[model samples]
Target chain A: MTKLLEANNLGKRFGQQTAVSDINIHLSRGEVLGFLGPNGAGKSTTMKMLSGNLAPTNGQILINGVDLLEQPKQAKAHIGYLPETPPLYRELTVREFLVFCGRLNLLAGKPLRIAVDRVIERCGLGDVQHRLIGQLSKGFQQRVGIAQAIVHHPAVVILDEPTSGLDPIQIRDIRHLIREVANEHSVILSTHILPEVQMLCDRVQIIAHGQLLFSDSIDALSKQMHASSLQVQLANAPSVSELSAIAGVVSVQTIADSTFRLHYQPDNDPTERLVSLAVANGWQLRQLVAEQHSLEDVFMKIVQREENSKDA
Target chain B: MLNLARNELYRLFLSPLAWVILALSQALLAYLFLSHLDYFMQIQSQIAAIPGAPGVTEMIVAPLLGNAAIVLLLISPLITMRLLAEERRNESLPLLTSAPLTAAGVVMGKFLGSFAFLLILLFMVLLMPLSLLLGSHIDLMQLASGALGLLLLIASFMAIGLFLSSLTRQPAIAAVATFSLLFFLWIVDWAGQSGHDDAGWLGWLSLLKHFEPMLQGELYTADVAYYLIVTLTFLLFAIRKLDNERLTG
Candidate 1:
């Protein structure tokens, strides 16, 4: 698959303070890359550079192999950006706004109409398509924002905090819409909501203090943090020393009086040996499930580690 | 660019601000037109005996167009203050900047859109002068030249207003700043009267100093060039402002 967007050594500085530094990103068609960062972590700055809304202080952006700085208009044709606030006209109806956005993106005639129609339907804006944007609910307004972003069928869609300020139901619906949009376009969705990233992103990039902390698929990220770890609950358990003495058990941490977290080597099938240990010792295994680290845990650990390194 | 211009025009017409400005301007101009016509009629016989006395074009049409220009000075700010300022306030400027449009195209498109609305007001005001054709003979060429002068004057004022709008996100600030700048330029020539030849540059740069000769039916290429220069200079400033916005946003 061809890469639809690429950033090399991207950096931005305001006065003397750096907003983002040496950022590199690549996205292919049919991929959704969740850009995760804490507040003030330069997520929006990076998104702005990719969308051509702000010029980078240093570095380069390529949209579909076209240099964004050298050929901005040609490169921007492949991009659609939905900023944090949605960039809506409160006085215009949803349909009118979409047509204006479509025309702005260089769509015309029947194709423009078809594109508007398809995006309206795709974003679930049919019910309020004719309503004025200010009259729509926040959920519908967010849909309109997404609708305008994708109306021209742009190859890359950059959404900054697309689900911000929405209710839970609205968030779920917007996430669903994002998934639908990603089927056809490369998407860069920036949010601090890790669960949203886990639910939607094919790959994830975590940024912290203007630096990249983690970049990989969600599964790969999980494996890196929780390799061969299991959470077990027993009716009658042995001492921690006895549990650590198991053939495959490398370490054991007490989670409760009878529950423990076991860590072992990746090549070792620790579950079988742990079950046998529990059976031999009459420690009835009530639960012995392999544990996958939550994204929040990994993210916090990465951020904490970065902070410690800086402090040292 | 044309698409943005078209959308700008649509939005301009949709807002009540444009319609209110149009109505109030027409009412004020009509009052001035009829008052001047009546005053001229009251003195017509007295002036008819005097050789080389002024007629309807000089007494009625010229001052009426002159008043129209002042009214335009007041309202063009109202029309143009929202052109780009509203987009910035609404945070919708990114929608344009992130599109496949050049910064120059966005600036030119906004200028054309605001100028188009001013033209509508100019045409309606011109109708007041053309109504003179119903009664007595009027110097049609003089009237046409004055009308062209007024168009250039307003176009240049709008360019200034567009530049001011580009500077601020507050439409009110844009409107007030535009009026302040235009008013300053309108009266800058007064300072020239007390100074020597070294200060003559003030009078040369004053808006009305260039506009007055055109009001008297004198159409010099220099006067037209003056208006064009002012319009193009401010338009370039507005375009640069947008370019800086994209760079620094």
Candidate 2:
């Protein structure tokens, strides 16, 4: 549970426009932290700063307790970054590029070759190891990109839109590969794909409009925005005020004539109490159930709240 | 650093563009000699006709090498235009910049790779002097000096090209800028001399003039220093530009 990376008050600006502002993020070892954001939301910018490709306009980045700007070589030693496009050379064969990458990471002799072989095998690039990179499919090329990034055996692997421009099967395969890799290295994957974060990432940080809205585990995020709801289907229509007056019932909304919904406070399981009250009132509770919160619902609610705040 | 340069050199060797430029330049240099063979033979015959006359090779050898240096200048921008420019265009500079290698290493490695290819082109043309001319007065030291001068000259311009390539992602733009800057330096030296007494030291800017004396057998420290400084300046410029890009972009 040690902190692997930290950025304090990190910011970036292009002339008059600020790409990122007042952002602070920290990651721990073996944590697959998903960076969820829309296009132009500064996900890529923040990642570039962390990976040593772009410097922050202001603030500090520490990798394994080392200041990035002060000791860049050491700071970058623990990071394996695959930019949005993978930064691959189209000319070199897969093995050659990886060998060069291993050397760039200062690996040589046995360890270098071992590292290259491990990553190439791990990335499933063994089939095309001798093929020119430009000749590979988009998925294969991305795999090579991932291979080169992790060839140095860094502590953290940062991928920007790793699943972008991929078919569903390829996306699933890559996501599975990411999960496998996450067992060893802390993963920071920047993606707008909701399912990618939900399925592969352990925690998610939602960024929008150059500001971080929230960062938490998927379960915690759902609990925050998803108010517990009591889904009751009555044989006949129930008065809104009647349902609202029920104990543990904070409010009532009508989804349909016979189906009424109840929003209640957190930690209060109102389904039993509501059923008791319905029995007392002789209301026909044909369907009485507890609603489960989904990640999609949570994401939409959080996004809506931000939009509301912007309007306010 | 070596790995990066090795990768760059591999790409240079594999690129069809490099071979196209090589073959094309070889033909041009050979033809430059072939078309003027009669004129050069006439001068050699004149020197031969006179007893104990200075050999034509001694007088025109440096100029011919300088002419080949000019060929280097012309074809180099084409070779170097893609070094950093295309990398930036394809968003590959970050791959190199983010690695453990420093900015200086990247620029120097690329410059050396481009210079290596230029040296190959110059070496390929050595047969021209060997097969065509029957002179027994070939000074091995002078030939080495001429090749060294051409290498130094090519290195200086390659540095300039490397710096210019870092300036833009558009290969055409970088190539044009390199040509314009080198062309200005080529004519600027003569123009500086034509300006009479007022324009002092402006003539030193010309790479041609500094390399001129070294084109002959004798090595001048000043010329070596001049080329080295220009090489160092442009290389430092490229490194600084790369560092700035990393910091701000």
Candidate 3:
């Protein structure tokens, strides 16, 4: 796949305070890279640098193989950015605003009109196209923001908190629009919503305290959410030592008078041996299930681990 | 650059503020023009006996245009206040900054947009004098010179407003600061009349001092250059301010 956006050693500092530092990120054509971070985690700062809205104190950004610092005009031509506030002109009608944005990105004549029409159609802005942006509902305004970002079909689209103030239905609509946009352009979505990343991203990067702490594929992250323990309930009580001695059982904990929680390696088999042992020893098995871990648990674990390491 | 300018003009016209400014200024200046003409008609025969005396262009058109300049001085800040400051306040400046444009392009586009609107106002004011050509002989050359001076003066005002707008995100503050700065420069030459030292340089620094000569049909290259230099200098300041914002903001 062609790399549409690339940043190396990207860092930004405002006076004595560092906003972000030593960050490296890249996106390929048609890829949605979710940028996850807590509030004040420098996500907006990084997005601004990548989109060329702000110059980095120490770094280089390349868009479509062009150096952003050396040739900002050409480099920015390939970038479409929707800042956190949406960057809208509320006085103009939706169609007029989109046309203006199209022209700002260098689209002209018939192409400008066509791009405006296409975005209005895609973003479900057709009904409100002639209405003033200020009069529209929040959802329609958000659609307009997304429409402007992709009006010229740039190679890389950077959206910062696109669904921040939206209601649930609007969030779903915007997410759907983003997914459709990902089919044509590489998207870097900066958001703190974990499920949003899980639903839309091919790869996810987590940033905290202005540093990139975790970066990997969604599948790898899902693996971290895999269950590593088994919850078992036997009608007839059994000794803790007897449950721990089962093949592949690493540890055992008594949850109730007759229940035990078994901790085991994912690759090992312990359920079959425990069941057979229960049958032979007259320990009646009542309930047995794996304890699943949610994505939030993994996120909290990662963030907490990073904090602890920093403190150490 | 042209696209940004067109967008600015489009948004400007969409709001009621531009229309209100246009109608009110034209109505006020038209009243001033007709009154000046009324006064000129009464004094026409009295001045006819005098040789090489002033004509209708001197008596009616010059003062009307002079009043028009003052009207523009008061309203130009309002026209220019939203150019950059409102964009910053509304957080829409990222739309321009993230586009494939330089800081100079953004500033010049805004300047041209507001300047074009002021030119329309100037043209309408000139039309009042042009209307007198049907009834009597008016000095077209003198009228043209005054219009040129007004043109340069309008440009200088716009550039100053734009530079000041770039310094703050509050459009109201931008308007107030622009008016205060322009008013000071307009009357800076008055200090020389009050028996101040270095009167020559103070007169040279006054915007109205440079503008007054051309209003009286005296078109000097130095006066033209002074307006041009002021326009260009403020434009450069606005561009530099935007570039600096990208670095430090």
**Tens digits of per-residue lDDT for model 3 on B105-161?**
999999998998888888888888999999988889988999999999999999999
| Candidate 1 TM-score versus the reference | 0.89
Considering DockQ, which of the candidate structures 1 and 2 is the better prediction for this target? 1
Structural similarity to truth (TM-score) of each candidate: 0.89, 0.86, 0.90
Q: Put down candidate 2 lDDT per residue, A9-106, tens digits, no spaces.
A: 99999989999998888999989999988888999999999999898999999988989888998888888999998888898899999998889889
Candidate 1 regions with alpha-carbon error over 4 angstroms: A224-296, A303-312
Better of 2 and 3 by TM-score: 3
TM-score of chain A of each: 0.84, 0.78, 0.81
Tell me the native contact fraction for each prediction.
0.80, 0.68, 0.88
Give lDDT tens digits, candidate 1, residues A1-312: 899999999999887899999999999988999999888999999999999989999898999999999999999999989999889988889999999999999999999999989988899888888889998899898899998889998899999999999999999999999999998999999999887888999999999888888889988765656757899999888889988988888899999999999998888867887787788889988998888656567777888888899999
Per-residue lDDT tens digits for candidate 2, residues B84-108, read 9999898888788788777888888
What Cα-based lDDT does every candidate model obtain? 0.90, 0.84, 0.91
RMSD of each: 3.8, 4.4, 4.0
Interface RMSD (Å), every candidate: 1.0, 1.1, 0.7
The residue pairs in collision within model 1 are none
lDDT for each residue of candidate 3 in A1-312, tens digit (9 for 90 to 100): 778888999999999999999999989888999998888899999999999988999988999999999999999999999999988998999998998899888999999999899988988888999999999888888889989999998999999999999999999999999999999989999998878998999999988879998889988877776877899999986889988888788999888898889999889969889888889999999999988665557767887888899899
Clashing pairs in 3: none
Give the least accurate 10-residue stretch of model 1 chain A, judged by summed lDDT.
A219-228
